[model samples]
Target: MTRASSQSDPFRLRAWIKVLAVGQLSYASAVAAADLAVPHPIAEGSNYTDWSGGYIGLQGSASGAYGDYAFSRTTVGGRAVPSFMSGDGTGRRDQGTTATTIVGGAFGGYNWQTGPWVYGVEADLSASNLKRPLPSTITGFGYEDADAFNIIRAKTDVFGSLRARLGYSFERYLVYGAFGLSGTNARFIGNYPDIDTGALNVAKHEVSFIGFNIGAGVQYAITESLALGLDYRYLDFGNSRRFSLGSVPGDAGGPVGTQANFNAHQLFLRLMWFPGGLRVPPDPAEIAPHDPDDGNSDRYSLHGQTTLIAQGTPGFRSPYVGDNSLIPHQARQTTTATIFLGLKVTDTTELYYNPEFSQGFGLSGTHGVAGFVNGEAQKAGAPYPRLRSNRYYIKQTINLGGETEDVPDGPNQVATRRDVNRITLLAGKFALGDFFDGNIYAHDPRVDFFNWSLWGSSAWDFPANLPGFTQGVYAEYNQAKFAVRAAATQVPKEQNSDVLDPRVFERAGLNAEFEGRYVLPWLDQSGKLRLGVFSNVGNVANNREIVTLTQLGIFDDINTAAVVTSKPRRKTGGYVNLEQALTPDLGLFARASLNDGRTTSLSFTDIDQSFSGGLSLKGTAWDRPGDTVGLGAAMNGLSPSHRAAFAAGYYGLLVGDGQLRYGTERAVETYYAINLTKFVTLTFDYQFVNNPNYNRDRGPAHFFASRLHADF
Candidate 1:
């Protein structure tokens, strides 16, 4: 019998975002129309506002699931075939396991109220990382019966529910219970690897199920339009019908029937917004008495942004190409949508979580140019949209006695008053660049320049995973005119790998930076300077050693294996960044960086030395102050040993031409941005590169791109 495929398709993240966003806008529009047609006023002497409206919410959940798996004997010609046998031929027919994971999702509902009771109908969808892998129970099986020690792995990637809610209200709080019909998209895999013959076989079953779930929860109204809630749920997916594992074929087990049942317990926190509800104006006493002028006083903040970039190269000079060389003609586009959520836990402490969805790739799969073309593109680009909890962190501020400044709300930053002199501590998963190597005119690819070297110090080799983030702690001491910062973050298990090394103390990255603000004496305009240094310690290869080993025939090809299998080593680097406003509308910026090239490049590019500088001017002179233009140039080089490795045919992470005639890779980029609206902008960019991949044999190359960016 053929196995059943999952019912749900691999829907893109961008599509989901669009659907949710549109739903919200439509509800809000209806609410506006109702308000004009009818007035909703606070009932005289009433203590509580009515809870009757259309609402939407986002939630984070922690859940644990238990499952049991069973298998039946298989028959190809009406003869029973042994299945899931031990190494010694003892039959084992069942397996059991449990898994704990985190989940993120969105929900929507409409509530109806009569007196103190409320009822609602709701629906939700979520992304989950629920998985459990059973250990190999039948190892050491011979080549003849590779399926004997089949290992089972089960996981649920996505789930959703359509539910009804009943609740009772008491002043500002509500208690509720929910019952729902739910569905889960799950996969089960069987791995059969033969130690004797070194052959591997994998069988997979992708299945979806509709089940039942029950839950209870409580919610507190922070305002008439917003609420916070805690929810608990229990879901039961009944035993699945026996299905054949025909994807993996062998005489040991032709096609065994398999079945499983799953149950999960979830506890989640949700933040909800009522589009048809009115917000209660806060009492003046609730504001911080010391700084009433500070922007927003709300304890929580929400912001979002989306960016779409389309880049291409009509055609570039390419006499020959290697494994990692850039294709002469290619065009690609990338889309990213992010939600920034923050909560002020106390006067001096804050928590932040940024859930992001990304899809598409950069030109040439983000390779070819040493100073890559798109800074927004992740190294691990995906053809289909994928969601990641990119940044979740805690921040504590220690304010030293000093004058304070009013802060405006922005992405990941809550609006309030902050002391001019303060010490801040941040711990969690984030990017090192969040606190180091900052330049006013050249930082933030989403806001300014788009080239890798221009937006960042390319030679710093900051520790990060494929998405340019890592788990770490950062500290900053701020003064009126100067600041100092330091951080320690996790490095990847291997270069450009998504998995971080587990040995935190032994394999890590340490970084520090000092920044100063001053007025340019000659120009009478403000300027800033930032100097930073870093050291990364991990198991990595040496370029010189790899070259020598290849010469001695120990390795057939100069490949990534040398770096993948290595002893502990260190890579050190430093960078200097400067930005000065030459005039009211024009600013100049530059960066110089170098890294010790004894060890192979890890986490970043192959360039050991880099110098990048640029100029940015506003459109104020032409009366379109919101529009802007930028120009930048970068020069990248390799150390002597690194040059030799490439010349000897060693492939670097991003660029290698099989053979090398060394020259500095030079790139110049220019862009014009048109402000389409307060929250959206469209930009046209062009770049020229000489000696692509630092190979003199390769002629000059040109690239063109268009980008659409929006934020709120």
Candidate 2:
């Protein structure tokens, strides 16, 4: 988690201002005393000398921007219409203007100074929720009343940026220019009509964008160790367009049109602190030497931390089956406690272990263990694959899956499975450079966990399974303000019992995913906006084994035969997104994605093509003692068919569809957090999802949760 000053609430602003004021007054008083105590004149340094040489410093700044966005008619159906055409207009239009955003980021830099000139590169990244309102206007024939006028209002969410800087120092002041790529995720909200009928449509949109940033700033040193500065940046997100067609006829045309050009700008005031002097000698002997065993000696340190987490789900029991007996609703509560421990052995290596124990009123208690090792394989620069760090981990558990079964005239079925736990080995190299970095690694090669649930409960337990191995390799690269990542996963049939069951073995196959982003520079740091693209493809053997646990529960036996042979079903799709920083604490984002009918497997599938966008606001509202907070909200939409698929998956009704349909739900969530003290915080979160296709009678379900966190 990243911690920064808040930008949203007015109370927070006043509190921070007071703190700064007090600090300034204290500094002034100290300076006065120092002036009276010192009498010697300070020596002047050379005018041609530059104040640079791999210096490190901390900076704090205030940032803000404006984000403008409009929804296209084609993306969603056009504006809403009356049951009977009243003559307001044949075609409806759903259009909105852009909103404002605000956010701030901290940065540090290093420079090598030469006479009158300093050159090097500096990089910084920030996470912010900058949002803007997605204003939607409806213009139609019979939609005259404001209440009858169908309109959708929403905001955008989370966004970020990365940039590099170059500069020249003159005496006590330095002027610099920077250029780097950036990206963001935006949200769009609106209401349209059904393609067939002229009814109103309500939904939210989440989008992504890639763009670039450019800025200039000048810093003046108050002393050799402190500096104050100001900077300005411009950002341009080229043609971030979104298209959609609504469910209704009137809403289908112009209302579903497009968002054309997007852009923004930002300005900030910054202060920096450098603890040590500007320069350090290449050899330790060049300067006064300190005792090796002194308190300030540089040496490796070891530390550790542990956390306890508790979670529960009410109203529904998980459908998975495990080793434990059936868990009763309301009658039996499932509770678990876990311990996570870590050891920092060196600057580049650490080891960790996490163990968990769970107990239920009517079921057997169980225990689980997981361990991991993380370390740098070699020094900064080493040969290719040999230069990679390796990580090995293993997890073992004995538990039930899903919910318990209540059979009418048969013996109750309890989870009964035990096999060697899953083992995972990962190795990857970290890149080093001012402009680029890359990592490549291979993931676990075995089916690590079995997912199952019994009838009548909402608890999901993991069952130990030693199925055939499933492994994948992934690589990612970041260069010139752009990032790209690709991954491929493969599962062979001979590794498990399913492979021997010809019907299931054939279903094993390969899957891959690729994504990239490019930042636009027209917009400055404050006005961040970017463009992004992503693609995914998968090939599955049709003859793979198929098992319908739900059907077996209903009929007490396998009732269906395998239909497709594992010949590798091919699925592929792609998407484009645009994100903009609207204010110092808010952001606007939009995106359109389309997936072909091929990659619809367990983890790689989409119900249908989707276009979404929304706004989000994230910033600290208060910085005073015991008064810190952050807040955020978002909304989105899904086609009816897609919504149905999602509903089915949520209810555990579709066994073989995999995890694809779960991505189709239309939903929204709001979150807020408050700091009670420096180490303690409270958070509240709520989620609302509408899945009309599942459970038939329950239109949508609302979930609420709260958490208290303490950091030591």
Cα lDDT of model 2 by residue, 1-712, tens digit? 0111223455344323322322232233224322112122222444422445344333322112344443333342433332211111101112122222234455666667665566666655444434333333344433334443334443444434566667775445567888877666665555654434646665565556788878766655544455545455666666565544233235224434455344555444344555443321122233345332333232222111111111111232223321111111111112122233433233223343434322211101110000000011001111101111111122122222343222111111111222222111222211111011111111100000000100000010000011112233333442333444443333322211122112323332322222233444564423222222223222232111223332344422221222132233443444444445555445554444444332222231112343434444544444333432222222222334334323333211122112122333344444454443333334443444443112222224343333333222
Estimate the TM-score of every prediction: 0.63, 0.32
In model 2, where do residues sit more than 4 Å from their true spots? Answer: 1-472, 490-523, 526-568, 575-580, 588-594, 597-600, 604-616, 622-664, 676-680, 692-696, 710-712
Model 1 over residues 357-420: C-alpha lDDT tens digits?
7655566567778898888878876543468999999999999977998766668877667899
User: Which candidate should be chosen as best, given TM-score against the real structure?
Assistant: 1
Clashing pairs in 1: none
